[model samples]
Target: MLKVKNALALISEAAKSWYSSNPFQFSAIIAYYAILSLPALMIIIFNIVGAIWGRDIVQGEILGEISRAIGRETAESIRMMLVDQGNEKTSVFATVVGIGTLIYGSTGVFFQLQTAFDRIWESKQTQTNEILVVIYSRLKSFGFILIIGFLLLISFVLTSLLNTFSKRLHRFLPR
Candidate 1:
């Protein structure tokens, strides 16, 4: 039918546009940033969720999920990396510098994604100040990281409640 042909044509055009965007190059760049950011991102997320759930529990739950997706060996290596990073002790000045670095690293992937999106959309906004723009971009990325942490906390709470409810329901039901 004409409708089916039109639908196929639309899909083909979208695919062509997507391919023209050089998605693989963007993906490689994003992956590189993500690798650099993972440690800082994980530390921030753990701290946020650990405030309520406790660090061990949150870390275990996250690592366990990762283990399921990947493998236990890889998960254990990630745990070791986190532990090694966290165990380091330094002077107050050094600590401040490290924290700043971690924040910058954590926001790298988000900033890169924002750049990629702007390029893909061909967005042009009037620039006021370069420093302010950089600050705003970093702050926006940091806000996104915080939102992710909040959502992870909510997910854990919901999963815990659901498991408890399921157990209680099982007790009441005639198996």
Candidate 2:
């Protein structure tokens, strides 16, 4: 079909454009994500220090005032939680809590970046296809990285097993 041919052409052209533009766009995205997350980083540090101290750092007086200036709801919530004592002590430090939060936040940015790139290709559309294909193309390029990660894991396991077996062999063979 003519439409199919046109769509393929568009896809090819989009892929070329995506390849040409990806490095700059991806780096810019990562930089912006780091910058925009400054507020969250503050929240992380405040939470961390609070956990370490076993009390909220920004709950009252001067620090509370500073937090209010930074983020109203967050500051108020932390203040209330600290003062009211309604919520149980988390018994977790900032660095530990932040790992999960960072994972979720980074996952959000990944989807957002995928959406942005797909939109870039969609704007060049000749016919309908899954927007996911553009996203898939980006992830496909990451396959090599994924393979390397898996290989590293396998290598670690194999090395551990070899060490254990060697120890067992030495014991059974009498030194």
Candidate 3:
């Protein structure tokens, strides 16, 4: 019982520390960057996905959701941007440049998230060179993006299977 009490105390202290770290400030910063970079990030994701799935199908669903959430005008703008980005026929150099820009743009939110998480974990130390820190941060954020992509693929597959099963069940049910 004493050990349980001690563990609780430790957890409470950690929670206090995290809350005192002004996490909301960092959250707002991340949100701002996420909004600013959303188009670029979506462009990169849809292009890669467009290779495997029809881009129009994906974009149509995304636009429908976005319209419901944001509004038709905003969704239309996003749709236009995604279409333009994915439809480009570019030279190798141009393609490389575009992808590089997308990576940098997309990682802004993740980098801010990492900074906030480090503070909450209280693992921040005297940092290394600025360039080195940026490089490491970008690499870490890119890893997060890859994980999200994997999770999204899993989600899509699961949803497809579930939808198919539900449709089959409906067909078998009495009206």
TM-score, every prediction: 0.88, 0.28, 0.78
lDDT per residue for candidate 3 within 20-120, as digits (tens), equals: 99878988898999998787667666665555656676677678889999999999988877766547678999988877988999888889888778787
Q: Residue 148 of candidate 1: its Cα lDDT?
A: 97
Model 3 lowest lDDT segment of ten: 44-53
Cα distance off (Å), candidate 2, residue 29: 0.6
Report the lDDT of model 3 for residue 70: 90
Question: Candidates ranked by lDDT, best first?
Answer: 1, 3, 2
**Candidate 3 deviant stretches above 4 angstroms:** 1-19, 86-94, 125-130
For each candidate in the order shown, give its overall lDDT on alpha carbons: 0.90, 0.55, 0.79
lDDT of 1: 0.90
Candidate 1 all-Cα RMSD = 2.1
- How does residue 83 of candidate 1 score in lDDT? 62
As for candidate 2, its clashing pairs are none
**Candidate 1 backbone collisions, by pair:** none
Residues 1-175 of candidate 1 have per-residue lDDT tens digits of: 5698899999999999999998899889999999999889998898889988888889899999989999999999988876677576689999899889989999999999998888788888568897887889999999999999999999999999999999999999988
Best by lDDT: 1
Range of the 10 consecutive residues with the lowest summed lDDT in candidate 1: 80-89
